[model samples]
Target: MTAGVLDEAIKKAAIAWISVGDGPAYALWCMPAESSILVVSGPGEQFAPGLAEAERATVRLRGDHGGLILVVDATVSRLTPGSDEWNELAPPLATKRLNASGTADELAARWAETGCAIVRLTPAAGSAVGAPDLPAESAAQPPRETPARVETRRPFRLHRVRKR
Candidate 1:
């Protein structure tokens, strides 16, 4: 039952919240492939720090209605460029990538040159949880500090000038 639910959720989800060991979770765009989920990260792509080095990570997926649906532990594996698995998954992933700057082949070449990582996240056996087991809290946090900020400005007021 858990495996079925997990698979379905992973299949339908375009994004998942992935947390590396002792780190805050980050929302990453992903694609489901067979029994595993594939994510591309590094330069010019979504940021998933320590994912390539980490052996395991937590994956939290939300339902269509915007509620946390499933949580699972996944074993992380990095796919080598030009390998069979990379060749098979890269095209599909590249096609699905939004706002990509180049063609699939170009992107793949760039990724290889820049050391981008294509990671596979396979759910650990019997580690899926859902529904009643999910946390009660909303888990929202304050936005991270950034250099960008709104500039203060005076409000404009319309005025009628008297005839000279």
Candidate 2:
């Protein structure tokens, strides 16, 4: 069933491309929950622009081969800090975060104090499209501009080669 595929894809995905209406998709780290995904955005976390204000967004999951595997429409809800839902999800999410500087509880506290938004994405019914239904287009885009670039220079030689 489509729901089964959606659930499995969400479970396996560590990152999902989330986009609000007509906006650029931002790849965000997420943790799968019961029929939903929890994503942290804002200060000291991944920048997910417009997610906190948007009521809905599209979530794209990729396969192991790095191809698009599933797409679904999701309802976005920003969880309130210190709520029961936040209490349940934050510590686990913090634990899953790689290279974190502190304990899970400490990270969770920081997230709350530093204005991070934890958005929950719950799939809308009948919105999942599995691989078979995916569009033919690859949807690739040019990489975003950044100040960083590789420096170019002449290659170093150990010694001059003799001409023959």
Candidate 3:
């Protein structure tokens, strides 16, 4: 595994897409620190239910053309707010966002209040997998085309037919 390169990619990418089991991929806002990816799920962020309880998860930092840039098979764990682990990690994630909070401390407190869960995805060894390219998913479920409507209006004569 290219640990150095993967870690650097993680640090550079502000968000990574993650999926668990056969579930759909979710756009997760993340911060990479200490060889792990930090993500928070709550009221406003992308919803990732059952992630904390899941044993293993997949984190992908994608590149152009739907290609997988860095794929990490990670172990998922939950960090309860106010713990030492939470203290060290959650604040940095909060700070990464523009409107999170004025300070990390305040955001941490908010996380506690809202029952948000901080998920830590630690990449497994030999899991810095890369893919050349992936076909687009638009074919599987194509978007529905909507019909255009023309405006309806009353037709008028130039001179109202000389007032009839």
Candidate 4:
């Protein structure tokens, strides 16, 4: 896809799931900025521990089609706090994070206080692909009915008494 289209898609996508190697991945609350993807990892959020040392990963973008728009082979980089990069990226990150916040100052302050780090992913071989197809039968089944009563008030007895 063209850079313009890619940027637009990333900007509109609110969440992206990142995968490294064959390990399990977690969702990222990320946004498109400066030709890269910016995501935050801290307390009370979902993020893979591997990303801290990962060299490359794939960023999955759910497409309008019934499939995924995968941006493959993205180089992972961490943006240090209080740097020029952080200063510029933080505003857009805060706005995207608190998408509904009337003001960003409070959220930004809280983010700093809570020690949040912004990780950047630069697409090396950006690609879009179809989502894996699964049979309808494989879908989750509804819960089955349960018994009406689970316990009784009578005390437990190890042995039954003979007719008395």
Model 3 off-target regions past 4 Å?
Answer: 63-67, 132-164
Query: Candidate 1 or 4, higher lDDT?
Result: 1
| The best candidate in terms of lDDT | 2
Clashing pairs in 2: none
Q: What local lDDT does model 1 show for residue 124?
A: 93
Candidate 1 structure quality by residue, lDDT tens digits, 71-111: 89999999999999888888889888988888987887888
Per-residue lDDT of 159 in model 2: 100
Q: Which residue runs does candidate 4 get wrong by more than 4 Å?
A: 1-5, 99-103, 126-164
Candidate 1 or 4, higher TM-score? Answer: 1
> Candidate 1, overall lDDT?
0.89
> What's the lDDT for candidate 4?
0.68
lDDT of each: 0.89, 0.91, 0.75, 0.68
| Separate clash counts for every candidate | 0, 0, 0, 0
lDDT of 3 by residue, 39-154 (tens): 88877665886786888998878554454577778899999877898888877778886675469778777877988878888888887775443334432333334466566798
Against the correct fold, how does model 2 do in TM-score? 0.90
How far residue 89's Cα lies from its native spot in candidate 2, in Å, is: 0.6
Which scores greater on TM-score, model 1 or model 3?
1
Quick one: ranking by lDDT, best first? 2, 1, 3, 4
Candidate 2 residue lDDT tens string, 4-111: 778788888899999999998988999998889999998989988899999999999988888898889999999999999999999999999999998999999999
Q: Candidates 2 and 3: which is better by lDDT?
A: 2
